[model samples]
Target: MAPPKPTAAAMADPSPWRSPAQRGRDRALKREAVLKAAARLFNEKGFHATSLDDVARQLNVTKPTLYHYFRSKDDVLFECCRMGLEMIEAAAATVPGSQASGLERLRALMEQYAEAMTMDFGMSISRTPDTALSPENRAELRRLKAQIDRALRGVIQSGIEDGSIAPCDVRTAAFAIAGALNAIAHWYKPDGPLAPAEIARQTADFLIQGLAPRTSERRQPKR
Candidate 1:
C-alpha cells in the first residue's frame, strides 16, 4: 500500500519553512508552547506519569506536530533543564558592582534567582530533575550546572581572598551557598508570607552571617 499524501498546510510554503529567521521564530513560539504544556503536565502529574500524548493534548496539537518541536519526552525535559540552568547563570550575572563583598554578591544573585525560577513558564532550578533525561541530555545539563557553580565560586573565592568572608574552602562554601539559594525555587510561594526578594534577603543573611568566621571563639595557641 502507498503512504498517505501530505496535507496542503503541511506542504504549503516549504520555502518559508526553510527560512532561518522565520523558522527560528516559529520554532521558538511552538517550543515555548510545548514547554509550558509539558511543565504543567509534569507538575500536575509526576514526570514519569506525563507522556508526549498528554502534552500534545494540552497544546491541541497532534503527536507529529509536537514531535516536530520536540523529538521525545526526554527532549522536552532537556529543554526544561536547559532553561532552569540559564536562569541560575542569568541571576548570578545580575549582581551589582557595588555589592561590596563576595557574600553580598552571593546574596544579590540569589535574590534575583528565586524570582526567575517562579516565572510561571518553566521549572525552577530546585525542582528540575536532571536524572530523568537521557545520558547525553544529562551531560549537557551537568555542563550548564558547572558553569553556574563556577560563577558563584568565583564570587565566593573573591570574598574569602579579600577577607570579607571567613577563610574557608571556596568550593565547598560556594556549593553550600548556591545549593541553599536554589532550594528556594522548590517550595517558594509567591502568595506565602515571604516574597522572593524577602526570601532571598533572609537566605543571604543566614548564609552570609552563618558562613562568616567567628572572631569570638577562643583561639588555641599554636603548639
Candidate 2:
C-alpha cells in the first residue's frame, strides 16, 4: 500500500509551519511579554502575593502557558530583577562616550536611573526581596548589583578629579545618591502629579547639588 497521503494542514507545508529562526523569534517575543506582565504584577502586588496565575491572567493566558517560558514564579521574579539591573547598567553604559564634566555625566546616568525606577521592570528591582530568590539567583543578583555600585563610584571619583564635583568620600557620596534614587521606586506612582521625567530631572538635580563644586572652589571672575 502507498504511504498515507498528507492531510490538508500538512500539505500547507511552509505556510503552516514556522522556520526555526521565526519560531525562536516568536518564542522570544512571547517570553518578553510574559516577563513584562509578571514584572508589572510584581510591582503592583508584592512578589509573595503575586502568583503566576495573576501573571497569566494579566496576559489572558493559562498558568501552564507561563511554564513554557519560566521554571517557576521565582524564575520570573529573578528575571524581572535581572531586567531592572540590566537597564540601570545600560544607563551607565551611556556615560563612557560623553565629553561632559564628571558631575554632568553622573547626573545624566542618575536621571536615567530615576526614570528606570518608575518603570515596571525597574520597580521590581527594589520591590522584590533578594531573600526570596534562590541562592544561585541571589548570587547573580549581587554580582549585577555590584557592577552598578562600581559604576556609581567611578563617576564620583571622576568628578572629584576633574574639580566639577566637590572633594568628598566617594563611597559615602555614591551611597547617598543611590539611596535617594532607590527611594523613588518605593514612592513612585504612575498617576502622581509629577511625571517620570520631571521626577528624574528633579531628583538628579537635587542629588547633584550636593556633589557639585562648592562656590569657593569655582574659578573667580577676572578682576
Best by lDDT: 2
lDDT of 2 at 209: 76
The number of clashing residue pairs in model 1 is 0
Q: After superposition, how far is residue 11 of candidate 2 from its true place, in Å?
A: 12
Q: Give, for candidate 2, the lowest lDDT window spanning 10 residues.
A: 214-223
Reference-based lDDT, residue 81, model 1? 65
The lDDT per prediction is 0.74, 0.90
lDDT of 2 by residue, 111-194 (tens): 999999999889988877799999999999999999999999998898889898989999998888888998899999999999
Give RMSD to native, each candidate.
9.8, 5.8
Off by over 4 Å in 1: 1-23, 120-124, 213-223
Candidate 1 structure quality by residue, lDDT tens digits, 1-223: 9999999999776553467887799889889989878876775577889889888888888888887877788888788767767777887777867447876776677667656656543343456577787999889888988898888888878778767778888788877876776666567666798776677677777887766666754355555
TM-score of each: 0.78, 0.89
TM-score of candidate 1 on Cα atoms, chains taken together: 0.78
User: The CA-based lDDT of model 2 is what?
Assistant: 0.90
